[model samples]
Target: MDHHEGLRETYAGEWQGLTNSEIRARYPEEYEAWSRGEPVRRGGGELATEVADRAVPVVLDAVDKLPDNGTVVVVSHGGTIRTMIGRLLDMEPAQWERFGGLSNCCWSVMGQGARGWRLLEHNAGTLPQPVIGDET
Candidate 1:
């Protein structure tokens, strides 16, 4: 298993370890901007793009080391994984929020296709069902 520190979640500066209510009470404006997907430095921490920049490379590097049919399992925090997916999909920072956050212990899957990378699943915990139109 490859572990990269760059895959760590966005640092929530002063908001670290605080509940949503606590952060909402303390940093209302910043929290609102965050909710709207506008870039705000949480507690003077990293931006979503910054997190993506650091994380995506690590993921790509791991992918490069895999055989064509091999699978790699990356254990990462939700925000970091989301950011990485946005980057991998060539999405603008604002569009990152379109991909909903993952529930605890849930995971996403991506596969390289003929066109490019595609998100096979999001926030999933079970084997994927066959697509309705697929024949195998």
Candidate 2:
């Protein structure tokens, strides 16, 4: 398994390690902007786009290494995974929030196609089953 610093979870700066209520109580305006999806950097932390900028390249690098019919699993936090998925699917960073947060141990799958990337699954906990017509 490869460990890449670029794939690390976003650094929330002043809001780091704080609980939900704590973040809401401490930085209401900033939190509100983020809640409205206005691209505010939470506590002067990285923007969601910035997170994708760093993370997508690392994931792409891994994808480039896979042999034919090989799969690469990316294990990361919810925010990181969400941003990466949005970027991978060519969605705007503002729309990335549409992806719901993942519970622990859940994973999403991305499939490459002639057109581009497709989200085969999201927030799944079980192993992948073969698709009836997807066989090569």
Candidate 3:
């Protein structure tokens, strides 16, 4: 998922507490452009692609430890989760931005069975609204 500077003394940095908007506003134009994937720009501090490169390995390692046909839940940030989705589903890295935001508390289910590891869901939105009495 996304990286954040933790409050722990060892993990904290001067810029750790700043939000994305703050980073964009305060940083140099090239930095912001890079972060945002602007044309011809190197982009900012870290790209989602880079994060995915690290996260997928750890996740697959953990999955390998689980029993066959077992179910696991990973509560992670949007970037991380989306990365997992793209990786598992054989989607391009850029596809994540195209899918748009993953709403808060949303989830995806992945399982390993006779068919091997697969994605059962991805960023499921809020439950569909029920029809009220007499609405029909």
Give Cα-based local distance difference scores for all models: 0.88, 0.89, 0.56
lDDT (10s digit) by residue, model 3, range 11-112: 113345777677566666755554465532233234556656666776776667778655445666775677666776667766655554567878766654
How many steric overlaps does candidate 1 have?
0
Score residue 123 of candidate 3 by CA lDDT.
65
- Tens digits of per-residue lDDT for model 2, 52-135: 999999989888988988888788889999999999999988899999999988989888877899888888988778788764
What stretches of model 3 exceed 4 Å from their correct place? 1-44, 111-118, 125-136
lDDT of 2 at 24: 97
Any runs in candidate 2 off by more than 4 Å, and if so which? 132-136
Q: Against the hidden reference, what TM-scores do the models get?
A: 0.91, 0.93, 0.57
Local accuracy of candidate 1 as per-residue lDDT tens digits, 46-112: 9999999999989888899998688878899999999988888888999998998999989999877
Cα error, candidate 3, residue 7 (Å)? 17
In model 1, pairs of residues that clash are none
